[model samples]
Target: MRAHIRSTSMHPSGNHIDAEVDVRTLSVALLSGTGRMGVHLSAAWAHAGMDVRVCSRRKEKAQQIVDALLSGQGYSTGQIMVPPHPCDRPAPSASWRLQAGRVEEAADADVIVLASPFHVMWRTLEPLAPRMRGKGKIFIDLTNPWLNTSAPKGPRGQTLPPIPKAEPQASVLFHKTRFNDPTSSWCHAYRHVFWMLIHPTGPNPRCGERLGVELLGDPRAVAVCTAMIKAHGFKPVIRPGGCEVAPRYEISMLGRREKGPDAPPAAGSDPDGLIGPFSASPLIAVDALLEKAARHFR
Candidate 1:
């Protein structure tokens, strides 16, 4: 996509820096889109009229996600054979495509969402680091490092021992290992999470109203991520400390498991009467529980 270049003085830091970004065409590539969160976000973005490329180790699973979105929703579907040259494809269209090649094919995208398992995430991303640098691309971390932990559960069914206090935040580690260089000034990395527990109910389900997203990253990166989150119809929350405070969010998930009415609804199930009433946004509700966990577990 051709980006109308504009130089802006404002950056995440107060200092003046020349950051060139394409605000008009927003394309996203989900690196591990076969997973539940990846599929949900991909479908939401496609539904929001944004271009999305779904990639996975298994191309069949990625293609299935694209087909499911087109069939499950009333969205139109089109196919374009990606050429060898990245710039040969037509301008960004509000459509979803399956990447037939490796993760390297997604490097040209404006945004890359990393939703893979924590164990394999870095291994998958390390090789792509060279292509991602200086591309002004935004990398969003949605992987929960503690996902595989088998710690004892609390009375409320919350996972115990939160992620080890010594473990570094996933986003921070990603930046240090991959994009930590003077030449990578244009690249921005973010740590973000979204809530999508509600299921489609009745003739029309307002799933967006129940879901929310939280972003913590550089100012410019957060701005791009915020716009993407809002486009998907989810409330976007920005944490002031950026990635520095990401550990708190990690710890929060272990406090209290949302259950009964407030817990996330099952896939394809109607959540109309299944969910309990709540006055606050789900992000805030979860944060509150995490705060309590920090005190109790720490």
Candidate 2:
């Protein structure tokens, strides 16, 4: 699918002035930068030339991750400028800097990506809520609520655990209630469809372009989040009703039947393979999801 490019208009002053400009140089704060998914996402955004601030309990670990992201692998370190706070009267100037800081620093960023484990999420963000309130910032939730537990051993000692319940939307609601930042908004919870780790050497090592993201959030915030997803080189599939639809996605994946090694490709009308909703064309997947949702909801 073709990417959606945000449009900008130029005005004729003595100097060419931009009438409107997209937030291309978004400043992102990753609260859990040292985590597995956090590192990949932080690197991906930084690789796309955005100003990224990674936060961790240990500053050294955060700095190491940032350094690895900035290394002259295949990725280029884009220019950075310090922009004014988004809530300020005048539009902020864009600035770029690769740095690691405490959670407090994340309050000033335009975008905040939360990748902490489900159990620790609230405790981690409660203190920062005051700092983040009223910034009109966009918060992206990238957490799966399932706890890791061991299952019974199979004949080959390879038993898999049952899939856990999905509650991503509840996380978003909790954030809003605790933060209560009326000025700010949150995009839907998002998860990568593929499992490969992205790094400076190759951002999309697992052919991420062939996969897509599943998102549930406010339309406006979803649009912004979608742009960021596209910047990371994946198509984004947005479902309405915010985080409410996330459980269905989880159940679908959990209940799917395993295909034999020689199983043929699923037919267009098949619902069995709907659990993994990602596709090279995200709209089609979204349509399928909508149909499934309608049936389930009705």
Query: 2-40, model 2: which lDDT tens digit per residue?
Result: 122354332211222222224456788888767766766
Please provide, for model 1 over 1-298, each residue's C-alpha lDDT reduced to its tens digit, 9 standing for 90 to 100.
5223356555444534334444346677888766656665666566555567888777776776565455443212121111111122332222444333346667778777887766567678778888877666667777655554324467998776533446554444444445564432222222223223321111113233434444556655666666666554455555555555455444223331334664433222323222212322446455435544554563
Q: lDDT for each of the candidates?
A: 0.50, 0.53
- The candidate maximizing TM-score is 2
| Candidate 2 residue-wise lDDT at 145 | 44
TM-score of every model versus the real structure: 0.60, 0.62
Where model 2 places Cα greater than 4 Å from the true spot, the runs are: 1-23, 73-97, 149-169, 195-205, 250-298
Which run of 10 residues does model 2 get worst, by summed lDDT? 75-84
In angstroms, give how far residue 106 of model 1 lies from its true place.
Answer: 1.8
